[model samples]
Target chain A: MSKSSFVAEAVKKYGQDRESLMPILQYVYEKKHYLSKEDMQEVAEALDLSSADVYGTASFYSFLDTKEKGEKIIRVCKSISCDLKNKEQIISAIESKLNIKNGQTTPDKKFTLLETNCLGWCHKGPAMLINDNVYTELTPEKAVAAIEENL
Target chain B: MSTDKLQKFKKRIDLIFSDVNWKEILDKALKTSADDIIKELIASCIRGRGGAGFPTGLKWKFAAQQKSDKKYVICNADEGEPGTFKDREILDKQAKKVFLGMAICAHTVGSDEGYIYLRGEYKFLVPQLEKELEEFHKELKAKKLDFKISIRLGSGAYVCGEETALIESMEGRRGEPRNKPPFPVVSGYLGKPTVVNNVETFVYTAMILKDGSKQFCELGTKDSRGSKVFSVSGDTPNPGIYELELGMTLDEFVELFGDGDTKAVQVGGASGFCVPRRKFKETIIGFEGIPTGGSMMLFNSSRSMYNVLHNFLDFFCEESCGQCTPCRVGCQQLLKGIVAVKAKEKPSKYLEDLKGMTETMKSSSKCGLGQSVPNCFNSIIDNFKEEVIY
Candidate 1:
């Protein structure tokens, strides 16, 4: 299946209405891991919306990355609760294991590291999301092990 | 049920986490008339659990009265407040209740469609929730009801928790708030009459419909009726969720949940008030005092109020939609102002100007996100001035 056809399938799964723009973008992003210029343009054309409008909506959400992302995106919780629990240590553990800093993608394109505000798991802080899977109550060892599982 | 010491403190209730017969609940609520359901909700006095504390009954009633061909019921599962996380628990434990609550509202308001806007962070729970939604639809169909509920995932943006902004995001637009007056109850969701409620609030409605309004009303104080779920975290042995009876004084709350060395408790979330040690006895934890959306973050003596306040300001700066000037600019300036104050570059007097700007944002900002910033800002600065200044 070609890229444009995948988007066409998503447009069919959800309607072509204005409301379908978000689901369509999400579907496309899930397959490609990010929305490139052409993917967003195709979504805009399919939904009969401006490319800028599609771009604006995608940019508004932290999960709807408009830029490039690797096969797996790791979002470490940086909110106050997670911060107090030493999220820096958790990030460092992943950073050393993956050989990439925060907001950077690995050379192999298998992992991307980023920090996010509150994943709603404050009680079990030091949490991170690898793609849609959530790992919580992470010690440095546990965080590294979770990343290693993906590897 | 109150003892000498316990009377001075909070009263814990077991209704929220207690067991329920969903089959019976569905049978009773579905058979009840729409008017009676709204009336019982009014009598129950249950308010929105999303921190805004709007009357849940009045919202359903207003949406019901609106004359539109299409109506909507939205369960706001976008739980992104800094310290709050009870909605996720509620959905995890009693998802059917949330769906049934939407079904009840749809029947009352004469609507056939509903949506649950779950946050992107909670995407892991999607499979189970979707599975339950299918079962819920089957139950509704067995009763021959016309209501249908679907789940929508919200890409992480805290401002989308606001109702109009949630509606806008549902329409595939930016999650920025719309101007008020024509609230979501009147003009919403494809420009139709709609009812948008917090995830926990919907659960409460389902419970209320089961046990009758009088039982729920009798639980809490006059001003705040029924129990509330509190997302308790930070500086405590017990750092999880609890459903306690409302009207507890802060002193009682601190006594129950605070660590031995606790210096303050940030009631609600970052957008909530900061109660220092001195004011705990006088502060109430309900609508009569400082109402919370159920975020109670305790801080021990070792932690710095400056750091806490800075964390919140940094969060606001990153999350602000940048549509409104007061929130977009005011958040950055406040964060910068504090750094300058702490470094002694700006005089201690400059904090007052920042306070003035918060007041301005409170009055002029487009939505609740900007308006409520003053709650944490003022309370933290006023209570922890020495920590903030030098």
Candidate 2:
């Protein structure tokens, strides 16, 4: 339940190197769903580093954040290629179906909707990333099914 | 999509790359006058399809004028930005065109060697491209040509997309941007003169050589000439690649996307300027009197401006390459301020700090990443101030 125990589970895979904190943080953030503040404190304490140090490394990247963890993070591709392909309908459908507007977490914290720029999959437009998995050629119906599967 | 227009366009392409033999294409293009090529290019007024809308011919002339025995022409295929994917499309679909284009640029610039710098994740695209290159190389070798080229894969670092950073990575260093002033046009790659261009830019060279600059210039606006390939994504129908003339307003573009059902469009990529719904019609994609070949569109109401911007800023914060104070430290501080504002945690205290830092980022920083990273912040604050300000 605490950050150290969470990290204790990770020590074997990540090793005890404080320098590995960023990589470890990335892994844990991906696994645990989000980088919790308490987890940041735990990482700092476990690595014998200051919380500011841990926070600095965590906050440095766009992928990691200290915000309250969401059940799902939807990064929709809004870059030019995807834009040409109609990413808007997918965003609106997903938002309406999820009952949460863009950038908002559901009341149950089942999802956090965010519109991400290009995931580099231009040929397949209207794409979204559910957690780390990329779902390409997405439609409004398909988006709902994908979220439901996660839920 | 009228048949006449489409037929005319296809006819133009067929007429251009008519000769299948690489040598024939090269010989025909080479014998064509550079002045004529420049003329056609200016007429087309095609903007550099790369992120920057710099005029392609002007850029070539600058590098061509600088007398250097070791000048290099680099094709930037390191497409790493999140929403952008047009470069890869060209590289994957019309690879022969890409190579043939590069060859023309090399010939025009009088460079003997060229390199195609691609992003690492493009693992699938590289091998296929390499095979095509081999065929082209073999044909050139058979023809007894002096020109040579090689491919360098970028290791998943967004910062390397910067010309200077790209030069560093090609030289086998960590992919971080270096100080400029001695731009790549002067000192680059192996400390030799280099002209780094987007994949589309080189591709256009083939067109210019084939068509003549004057003809090419005639396609787009008088100032911003040539056709632009926009990666249209987001809300609307037919979200795919659209090749349009320069000076096409965003409203016209959105209408092409299907109906008027749209919210915002993120022109350029992560480092590009964002035009809100209100200003979409007024903005025209172009360079210094030209259009950049790289136009990415982000659409739809499903996306919130706040989240899109936060994600962009966060990407900049992580990928600053840490080479300078403004970009390295300033990005982090700005991210913190964004988070604080979003959470409504001491919002006023961080707003001015964010503003001051953005001004510094724009004023200082070594390259485009540091300087333009602030644009993400500025656009969001100006366009989506209500969404961001708690």
For model 1, name the residue pairs that clash.
Answer: none
Predicted model 1 interface RMSD = 0.7
Q: Compare the candidates by lDDT and give the number of the best one.
A: 1
Interface RMSD of each: 0.7, 7.2
Give the clash count for model 1.
Answer: 0
Where is model 2 more than 4 Å wrong at Cα? A1-118, A122-135, A138-151, B1-23, B33-46, B66-69, B288-293, B348-353
Residue-level lDDT of model 1, residues B47-160, one tens digit each, is: 998999999999999999999889999999999998889999989988988888898899888999999999999988999999998888998999998999999989889999
Query: Could you estimate the TM-score for every candidate?
Result: 0.97, 0.71
Candidate 1, residue A52: lDDT? 94
**Judged by DockQ, which candidate is best?**
1
* Each prediction's DockQ against the real complex: 0.85, 0.13
DockQ (C-alpha) of model 2?
0.13
